[model samples]
Target: MRDSFEHVYQLLTCYFVKVRLVDPDFVFDIQTTSCKDKRFTWYFWCFGHPTKTYKLLRPVVMNDETFLKGRYRGSLLTAIAIDPSNHIFPLAFLMKDSKTTESWT
Candidate 1:
């Protein structure tokens, strides 16, 4: 069992090393915690231009659905326009079981 754990650990270490090699300018961190309960974290960001790059590239139409993972189950759909820098613009959120392009946008 110990050998198997070590083997997987080595594989994960190599994966992170590859990410670093490809994105030397940006920073990436992956954290796992189990103090009270297991939690996983990951974040990635790039060194970018001084000016806000999130200019609206074009008019956007989006439709997505989300649901509760656990208790108080409900579903919602969100439609949004995103900008050039990956920022949400012209955004709207709605809760529905079903929706359409005309109804959302």
Candidate 2:
């Protein structure tokens, strides 16, 4: 799966671009080593509503990480907040090769 990192990176950039196209407020970031290497990291988030909407929601957010049990092992990190309507509002998501304090920070 090492060779697929480039493909995954391309797909994720495309996905984020499409999301931003639909909702310009969405924000995303991509980080990687030098072009000579292919290790990559991605982070994306959307407020889902106006800035005022955030004040209505609780001022609490939760984060979690889980190891992926798939062909290419990795970790999925997610940030979630509870909206005023009591529905889950996913704020951010990240995928990384491993779970570590460095990555989480």
Candidate 3:
């Protein structure tokens, strides 16, 4: 670990990636400590949510060329649906811009 923001970002990306981009209720802060002197001083912030985020994942039939942020950034041409279990499941999302099919896969 070289002590950078990307290190913390990567560690977070690898660990707490269960719910995608949405944050939980109690995850209130992010900090990094540097050894500037004999004492360890940490830099941090309050990133917690004041209100809870409730999402009702429903079964959706979609067809759109949307924008999605990947690891390298690219166009997200996708069709997704939420199962009855509230899981954000991915459906068929790969097609041309003009090709209109009933459903993605």
Candidate 4:
């Protein structure tokens, strides 16, 4: 996992670029600290299709998060909405170093 983190920025850059190519409306944000270590702070992404389709779904949005268990612990936060047909509609997702008030904002 440590090795993977070394290349995480590069990998994510490629991924975000590819996503943009396929979906011009795809949106993403990656935040990093400017400390000596340059640690990754948080990441957020929302696909183009979901953004366009969200208007057709119910207005109510539900959010949930799960703690990650591994060498580098973190939380995976997700936002979702229910469609008129009762199907789960994913709105967005976030990965952060930890679950904190600042992270939620």
Candidate 5:
């Protein structure tokens, strides 16, 4: 399963690069401990609107995490902010092998 995910990972890398080029505020990062290791961690964030329009949004923000029970067990952290119009906007996302203070922070 990990081998099969290689292709998808490559596609996502390309997509992320393109998105960053198109939207300067689109930020993403992939981190690894060893250069030869296949295991890595990543996060995504968008500041395009957040930097400019955050003041227009309500002060209410929510965050949550969902655990995955698959081969590569992990958790996805997501944050959403409520806009003045009562719309929920995804503020950021993070993928970690486990939930911890280090990962969540």
Candidate 6:
């Protein structure tokens, strides 16, 4: 687990690049501290297909967050919408070191 976390930046970069290659409209944002020892702060991503499909889904969007446990503690945030058929469709996701008003913003 520690080993995996150590390579998170590289893995994340590759994952984002691959996603973008498959989806030109894939949207993502990564933020890190500017301190001497840079650290991961938060990450947000939304797939291209979902953005396009949202127009055909219900107007209401639901979102929620959960606390993560284990070596790395954090919050996982997600937003989803219901389709015309009442199927849940994911819209976006976020992972942050902590959950706060500033993080939500």
- lDDT leader: 6
Q: Cα miss at 68, model 6 (Å)?
A: 1.2
lDDT of each: 0.44, 0.71, 0.38, 0.81, 0.71, 0.82
Using lDDT as the yardstick, the better of models 3 and 4 is 4
Ranked candidates, highest lDDT first: 6, 4, 2, 5, 1, 3
lDDT of 4 by residue, 1-105 (tens): 134655865477578888889888888998887868777788889877675787899989999999977666788889999989999988889889886787767
Runs off by more than 4 Å, candidate 1: 1-57, 96-105
Winner on lDDT (5 vs 6):
6
Q: Give each model a TM-score.
A: 0.32, 0.74, 0.25, 0.79, 0.77, 0.82
- lDDT at residue 64 of model 5 (Cα atoms): 93
- Model 3, backbone clash pairs (residues 3+ apart or across chains), number: 0
Candidates 1 and 6 compared: the better one by lDDT is 6
By summed lDDT, the worst window of 10 consecutive residues in model 5 runs over: 1-10
User: Where's the lowest-lDDT run of ten residues in candidate 6?
Assistant: 1-10
lDDT of 5 by residue, 1-105 (tens): 145555665566677788888888787777655678756565465546566767777887799989867565777888889887778888887777666576656
**Residue 52 displacement in candidate 2 (angstroms):** 4.4
Model with the higher TM-score, candidate 2 or 6: 6
Task: For each candidate in turn, give its C-alpha RMSD to the true structure in angstroms.
Answer: 12.0, 3.6, 15.4, 2.9, 3.1, 2.6
Question: Ranking under TM-score, best-scoring first?
Answer: 6, 4, 5, 2, 1, 3
Instruction: Give candidate 5's TM-score.
Output: 0.77
Please identify model 3 stretches exceeding 4 Å from their true place. 1-59, 67-75, 95-105
Question: lDDT at 8 for candidate 5?
Answer: 60
The reply for model 4, stretches above 4 Å from the true place, is 1-5, 8-10, 49-51
Q: Per-residue lDDT for 1-105 in model 1, tens only?
A: 144533643455466566568756433344444567433222223322212333434555777778633322334555566677767653444432224353334
- Of the candidates shown, which would achieve the greatest TM-score relative to the real structure? 6
Report model 4's TM-score to 2 decimal places. Answer: 0.79
